[model samples]
Target: MVIAIGFEGSANKLGIGIIKDGEVLSNCRTTYITPPGAGFLPKETALHHRENVLAVLKDAINESKIDVKDIDVVCYTKGPGMGAPLATVAVVARTVAQLWNKPLLGVNHCIGHIEMGRIITGAKNPTILYVSGGNTQVIAFCRKRYRIVGETIDIAVGNCLDRFARILKLSNAPSPGYNIEQLAKKGKKCVTLPYCVKGMDVSFSGILTYMEERAATLLKEGYTEEDLCFSLQEHVFAMLVETSERALAHCNSTEMMIVGGVGCNERLQEMMEIMCQERGATLFATDERYCIDNGLMIAHAGAEMYKSGIRMKWEDCTILQRYRTDAVEATWRKD
Candidate 1:
């Protein structure tokens, strides 16, 4: 029985979570939202995290009804994110660990998403489709790590969507991607767009470039924004589904899991469900609670590693901007 507190501020969102054993007790977060046609800057995102993390942590603790002293371990995302935001969370985590006299665990942001997906959906040994603003990969447990079977060659899916939203000056209230998903629902026309998939990998930069040109031309030509949104989602999601199917075929696995910010798209899920149905396989997914970046995942994954005796000192909490998913040794999974 272990109680753990986890902090996550790897990107635009700042989150705090508490976990007891393998179950999530509370998850609280605040996203740093930029205005339309804008993207979040590292420094600004870091400042947002610094301002809101403590309050989020307090809320998490209060919601969980757990004393700070009862927490056995402190965990925070250590890598594969913006340096400023990562450092912001690390400082808070280290400070809390020292103040509470608890051991510290540094967790990989990508692994946090994967582990939380597995725990919430109970999909063992499934092929992973990790699509986010910074990352896009198809992963599976190989030997002692999550091996990347397929991935993006350029920008990620979520990055493409965000940039497109900026081009159209779309609102960033909830999220650019979510807004696009809603616009896509009102589309009936399917305009042609580039779908680039090389081997088992996918690329979104070319698609984004083409979509930008089309968006400008079509908007001038009295084409609806909804049509462009629909076309973009259809083509890109098809590419992703195709790549995932190929990975599943190569691995001969009957289960597939999607984890990341873009995983919240209903069209992506619908396309993936069709793919799974055709292959007679099961699809596993969680709602945005576990799909999007959150401290709950950090807590759950770090707690697992900590229970396995993994610990890190304050001096060793270095953060990486491009930590690969396959780099970490998967100590928790036997397969």
Candidate 2:
């Protein structure tokens, strides 16, 4: 009976989870965005985590109705995130583990997402479409390792969404990503945006600039905002779909799984599902609990590692700003 606690502050979201064996006992998450309602701000992010990490952790434990003394292990995200925020989580988890005399395991944020996706989709060797404000990639497992087949050269898909949402003044009144999706629904016309595809690498900054210029021109002519949103979603989603399909073809993997923040988009999931179906590929997603950045993913992953007697040394797990997904070695015991 291995009970584990997981803390995550790797992104704009704060998550805490308690796990018993391989099942989640309780999972909690709270979101805090940046100042001026823009993208994630490191200073503000650190401050937010420092302020609320403890409350969220305690609340999660209470809500889960779990006893702290039963905890045998503790896990915390160590890197691949805002340094300030990740540090905040590490400090908290370290303190808690120290207090309880529990051994702490430092988890990789990207691998956390991938492991959660595996749990959600149950796709043993699926081709991965991972996109977020921080990462955009086409990945697959090979030779006991995750390989990055393709990715964006500049600007992740979610960052493009957030920036465009700011450009349209959609940050305050409603959620930026959700608002942009709504606007895209109202858009009736399509506008041609720059498509930069270099082998497997795609660049969204150039497309973003073109769309911004075109949007300004349209606004000058009183063009509808809905149409602009629609065109943008169409073009961006098409590019993603094209690259995903190409990766699938290259890998010859017919199973597709999406992970990351943007993976929450119903529209994106629908598009990927349709693409996967076209090629007779099966697609699966999280069952709410593992969908967003929740501590459950980390705890669940840690529980798996703990069961196998795998652990990370505190001195070895460094915060990585430009860490690639393929860099981490896989520990899954293939039966």
Candidate 3:
């Protein structure tokens, strides 16, 4: 009968969610969107979170239909995100925990996504492909750790798409990547882009650089934005699929779960589904609700950790901007 509330402000989005046991009661969020051709800055993003977090939290609690006094734990994302945004959410989480006299737990951002995916999709011991604005990795649960099998050597795939969207001046209303995905659907030509996959790892910086240098020239030479977006997705997603297949083989796992913001892309999901069918594996994925960054993930992961006897003191609840997914012991998982 444990009740937990989680706060997440890792990047541009600020989310608050409430969960009881393993079921999500409510999930609320707001995004700090920047103008076209621009990315969000940490300080500004933090300011947005500070301004909106309380409202979002109120919404979550209200929607959950729970009294604050009933909450047993307060959770927040502690790492692998922008410094200002992470600190902002941590401050709020700490304040709430102290005010409510509840236990506080700090969760790794990546593990939050993975745990949420597992809970929502009911996938057990699946090889995971985590792709987001800040990270790109192929992972598997091994020896109480989410071991990385393959990763990006440079920029994340989402970051690359976002940056390219900026070059194309795509709207950041919902997201740059979403806009790119939509444009790609209308593409009639497939321009060749650099595909950088080195063994188990993939790289997107070279492809981004090539696109940045040639975007204007290619447009003038009869290439549409849709064409460029289509080509970029084709190459990058192929790279991801290739590495993910190898990871599945390496881990000998039959299930593949995709988690993170970019996991919302239908084309990527379609591509992965084809690969899974060929490999005789299952693909587990959630929609934007669980795929993108959200507070429910933090609450879910934190609840798992708390149930497993993990706790944090007030003094120990600090942010780690570079926390790795493998650093946290998956004590909640026995197998």
Whose lDDT is greatest here? 3
Error of 2 at 295 (Å): 1.3
Q: Write the per-residue lDDT of candidate 1 for residues 1-335, one digit (tens) a residue.
A: 98888899999988898899887799998999999999999999999998888789889999999788889999999889999999999999988888999999889999999999999999989999999888999998889899999999999899999999998899998999999999999998888888899999898999898877777888887779898889899998999999999999999999999999999899999999999999999999878888889999999998899887777766887677888889899887796
Candidate 1: which pairs clash?
none
lDDT scores of the candidates, listed in order: 0.91, 0.80, 0.95
TM-score of each: 0.98, 0.93, 0.99
**lDDT for model 2:** 0.80
lDDT of 3 by residue, 1-335 (tens): 77888899999989999999888899999999999999999999999999999999999999999999999899999999999999999999999998998999999999999999999999999999999999999999999999998999999999999999999999998999999999999999998888899999999999999999999999999999999999999999999999999999988889999999999899999999999999999999999998889999999999999998998878889999999999999999976
- Number of clashes found in candidate 1: 0
Q: List candidate 2 stretches off by more than 4 Å.
A: 34-37, 172-174, 287-289
User: How much does candidate 2 score in TM-score?
Assistant: 0.93
Residue-pair clashes per candidate, as listed? Answer: 0, 2, 0
Give the least accurate 10-residue stretch of model 3, judged by summed lDDT. 1-10
Candidate 3 regions with alpha-carbon error over 4 angstroms: none
Ranking by TM-score: 3, 1, 2
lDDT of predicted model 1: 0.91
For model 3, the local distance difference test gives 0.95
